[model samples]
Target: MEADMSAGDLDRRVQFRRVTRMNTALGQEETWADLGSPVWASRRDVSDGEKAAAGGVFSTVSARFQIRSSTFSRGITAKDMLTCDGREWEIVGIKEIGRRDRIEITATARTDR
Candidate 1:
């Protein structure tokens, strides 16, 4: 557990969302839907990197979020996305702290979609 981090440290509110696939007149379309209510979390910048593709360079920013563990948070996975401050992040890693007392999520800024 993060003994030094108190609930007050979780100053930011973030929401989790998952992709929902639906059949359309043309074909299947994927949309995002909220997974649960917003939760308090501490956000911290992790890293910044660049990717090159198709003769272009794209910048990527990664961040880590720490939140108290709960039924809603426990269901979060790499397939889910988190949004805060009007920005969307792609979940990359999840680590349980002290037997699920807390969860640390590593995410990268979404640029592809």
Candidate 2:
């Protein structure tokens, strides 16, 4: 039988569309245009290590890619921040962590996409 898609459902079976991005401070809110592709993962709480990269040297250190819904809200267990159009924004929380509502994502200070 075929299964359908659900919100926040990480289906390892079908390989969900995980969009990884290198978060950072841009001076304002973020947008899909600013977000990188393939979903770069955060190096984690640690300061150094390998993660993921998009449009740069493959050897470049990877950035963080926390969950972000197009709609902004609060309640997500993990704290987040975002940047878009070169502006920085704090992730208050997630109103809905669906791809439809998700948009902005914050990164560590001075980080680049």
Candidate 3:
């Protein structure tokens, strides 16, 4: 199905950065590179999952972002990060809308702390 992304639908502006891993002498280091300009998107909290494991409880908050595909290239993948409202989120999943007209990004942030 196609996503209806009218001007009023996109109420938030978010920036996307591609995550690149470089192998250093010590270990693998991740670097964030700006993909393009900030794009208008509709953001919402998708779900929150928590579980008691080992010593403490593990919790994660998943968020969803809907953006026009034209705003970005097809290079965006799960190895990217989204910055919204001064918070950094790691992209966990991505869904392309019909005909690549829009994209739905599912990201998560640790909330255990």
Residue pairs in steric clash, candidate 3? none
What TM-score, over all chains together, does every model reach? 0.89, 0.21, 0.75
Worst 10 residues of 2 by lDDT: 10-19
In model 1, which regions exceed 4 Å deviation? Answer: 1-4, 110-113
Ranked by lDDT, the better of candidates 1 and 2 is: 1
Cα miss at 46, model 2 (Å)? 34
At residue 64, give the lDDT of candidate 2. Answer: 35
- Global fold similarity of model 3 (TM-score): 0.75
* Candidate 1 CA-lDDT value: 0.90
Native RMSD of candidate 2 (Å) = 14.3
Put the candidates in lDDT order, highest first: 1, 3, 2
lDDT of 3 by residue, 1-113 (tens): 55367989889999989877899999999888878898899988989999787988888889989888874546788878888887788998898887877888999977755
Compose the digit string of candidate 1's lDDT tens values, residues 1-113. Answer: 34756988999999999999999999999999998889999999978888998998888889999999888888899999999888899999999888778899999995544
Instruction: Tell me which of candidates 1 and 3 scores higher on lDDT.
Output: 1
Model 3 regions lying over 4 Å from their true place: 1-3, 21-29, 51-58
lDDT of 1 at 103: 94
